[model samples]
Target: MLLLFLLVLFTQNYFSHGDLIADTCKKTEYPRICVSTLRSNPDSKTADVKGLVRIILKAALGKANTILNQANDLLKKTKDRLVRQSLNVCVSVYEEALDEIPEASVNVGTNNFEANIEASATIDIADDCEESFSNSPFTADNNAVKQLAVVAVDIIASLG
Candidate 1:
């Protein structure tokens, strides 16, 4: 009897995790990316919606910080004044976006509306960064930053 009970409990938990991932991913614009990224994290196996958003937000922030660091490094390597200026702009914009992530995470617990707004603002910062390089030869970096921003936006929209 105890063995049967344990089997049932384990089955329910396993199915529940799958269901939660499906439900959560369905809410996002990029369902595939959402599912794959969240599933890669062990915590998502048991996290509720808010917890999942928090995780996504943290991941987005990490990406933004990475871009910022890359921009800074590029600035040091490039001697052209225009390229250095563009990289500096990217660094600053990413910094602002990174600042908003914690605020968004805080708001996620009690007010998803505010959290969404904050997240949307973060996306805008990324757009500004991309636009800053419109005439520059940094298309690859710009696209990479835009992709990260889109992921962050998709995660925010999922909170709805």
Candidate 2:
């Protein structure tokens, strides 16, 4: 009985953290991003699902801030009226997404599905930003913004 107990304890301790993270990541739409992001963060190394959700939310918020900053900076540099207009739209879209991130983060803690819906809407913001630059000379910028938004969407999907 003593040996059996010791073996069980060792196995549980050995597998619990890593296994928990991997299992949770598997549920996310972007498993690679989910696993890589969680594994890279020291705080998430031993986190449960709730903890992982918070970590992911934090990361998404940071990414949204980055997108917002990038849009603002681009708006300042470009002299083209059309490009500036498109970038302005991007700034507004990212701002809304940034606001949604914190609200979603809070609601996610309580298992609120509405938070997931709000978070998912962030993708539409990115799409609109990209569409604003359609047939314009801002293809690279559009792609970059869209990529960041995709990451946010993936993070939100994981929350659901």
Candidate 3:
């Protein structure tokens, strides 16, 4: 029974989601990222537009959380006061983002979905964190979250 359910679920996502995912992604700024990210999630197989936003937001939140953890770890290990100050700023900004993503996710299903401000805010948050350092902190992690947030903005705008 478990195997049967798994097989059925796999086929359902494989066949049904292709066109929907492609169609939706076409309306976004980052079509490739949008398509690949949505297709990678099993829940997205049956999810509509709003559901896709939630998935993207959740992924962004996860990435931000990881970046925060990394920053915190680096903060404890580094001796430079300047780097420490920058890491502190990144940690604060990321925490702000961490709070916002959940609210954005909840707002997805509510009347405020379109009114939510995270579309540009997420990008700003990532950019702000990046700019805090002289050289740049969490290079790869910062880029990843920024890209995810960009994808989120495109798709979230489509919701409007």
* Top of the candidates by TM-score: 1
Off by over 4 Å in 3: 1-16, 112-115
TM-scores for the candidates: 0.85, 0.75, 0.84
For residue 133, model 1's alpha carbon misses the true position, in angstroms, by 1.4
Please give the range of 10 consecutive residues that has the lowest summed lDDT in model 1. 140-149
**Tens-digit per-residue lDDT, 1-160, candidate 3:** 9999999989987777677788878887777777778888999978888888788888888889998999999998999999999999899999999988887777776744542576557778888889989898577778777777777767776677
Between the candidate structures 2 and 3, which one is better when assessed by TM-score?
3
2 or 3, which is superior by lDDT? Answer: 3
Q: How would you encode candidate 1's per-residue C-alpha lDDT over 25-142 as one tens digit per residue?
A: 7766666766776788888877887777777777777767777888888887989887787888888888888788889888886777788778777777777777777575445554
Best by lDDT: 3
Candidate 1 regions with alpha-carbon error over 4 angstroms:
135-160
Per-model clash counts, in order, read 0, 0, 0
lDDT (Cα, 0-100) at 155 in candidate 3? 70
TM-score of 2: 0.75
Q: Supply the global lDDT for candidate 2.
A: 0.68
Provide the lDDT at 139 for model 1: 50
Query: CA lDDT, every prediction?
Result: 0.74, 0.68, 0.80
